[model samples]
Target chain A: DQQVKQNSPSLSVQEGRISILNCDYTNSMFDYFLWYKKYPAEGPTFLISISSIKDKNEDGRFTVFLNKSAKHLSLHIVPSQPGDSAVYFCAYRGSTLGRLYFGRGTQLTVWP
Target chain B: EAGVVQSPRYKIIEKKQPVAFWCNPISGHNTLYWYRQNLGQGPELLIRYENEEAVDDSQLPKDRFSAERLKGVDSTLKIQPAELGDSAVYLCASRLTGVADTQYFGPGTRLTVL
Candidate 1:
């Protein structure tokens, strides 16, 4: 069973525009959420994370908003650059531990 | 600090052949994890180890797959009589402590079964 889901398979955005990616989860026990960026043939790298208590977290040009009641979260990247064009994965950490459950990933293409 | 290290970035083996992948975690890290990632999908945990003890391995296919972290440091994952379905990227990650810690990932070893 896929506990985390990224409904959108792909997204295209123009350079310097805002890019939004969404994720949904089925488990309520997850307390920590993380975003990862991946390039082809490479392992994912941690981008940003948020604690369950917070509804929104921002890191420079990236921001993550969580809605516990809806079991959903989103990542927004502003002034999207060509370098930001990669697969974005949303993952959740276990309540007791840091084990992660990941979504299928969304491929974002930023056209310059 | 050096990140997790994995050897043999790419491998291609025939079905029924034996294949092995090696990993060396970051220095001073005590928690190690193994994960399998399929194309276009997210990674799934294969096993987790604390020091030299395996704490979780429920997702591992024990029939033909086995792993060992003998010295509480470097690890090896082996598959015997490999199958086509086993083709995927195997990633190794290391954390400084228990589950709540952040994990650092390696480049991963991609296996292609012919």
Candidate 2:
């Protein structure tokens, strides 16, 4: 069973628009959530993260919102640029051994 | 500083053949992880090591897979009698001992078993 899920397989947005990617999880015990951006043939790189204690965390043009009651989270990138086109994955930090549980990932395309 | 390094970026072999992938984590990082990602799917953890000790490996398929981390710096994952279902990209990641979320990853080795 997948503990984390990215329901949307892909998302497309115009440059300078906002791009929102959603993710859901079945486990409530998780406290930390992270987003990673991956380019083709490259490893996933860390984006932004939110702790359960807070509902939102923002880093530059990227913002992540968490709704614990709904067991859902979303990543928003404002003024999305062409460089933002890539696959994005949502992961939760495991409380036990600190391993990461990742979602299937969503491919984001920022068009000019 | 160099990031994680993995060798044999791509490998192709017939079923029942043996294959090995190597990983060298970033300098000073004590935690290493090996994960396998199937096509169109997220990466799944196969094993985790804290230094030379494998702290967790419950997800690894021991019947055909084995891994070793000697001297707490580099690791090797080996698969014997590989099956067609073993086709996937194997990724290696590492982080500092106290860091909980940030992990540097290598380009990964793409393995194809025919």
lDDT of 1 by residue, B49-90 (tens): 999998888889999999999999999999998999999999
- Per-model fnat list: 0.63, 0.63
C-alpha RMSD values across all candidates: 1.3, 0.8
Candidate 1 regions off by >4 Å? B98-100
Clashing pairs in 2: none
Name every residue pair that clashes in candidate 1.
Answer: A98-B99
Lowest summed lDDT window (length 10), candidate 2 chain A: A93-102
Per-residue accuracy of model 2 over B1-114 as CA lDDT, tens digit each: 999999899999999999999999999999999999899988889999999999989899999999999999999999998999999999999999786568888999999999
Query: Candidate 2: fnat, from 0 to 1?
Result: 0.63
Alpha carbon lDDT at B47, candidate 1: 92
Best by TM-score: 2
Q: Give the TM-score of candidate 2.
A: 0.98
Provide per-model DockQ scores: 0.74, 0.80
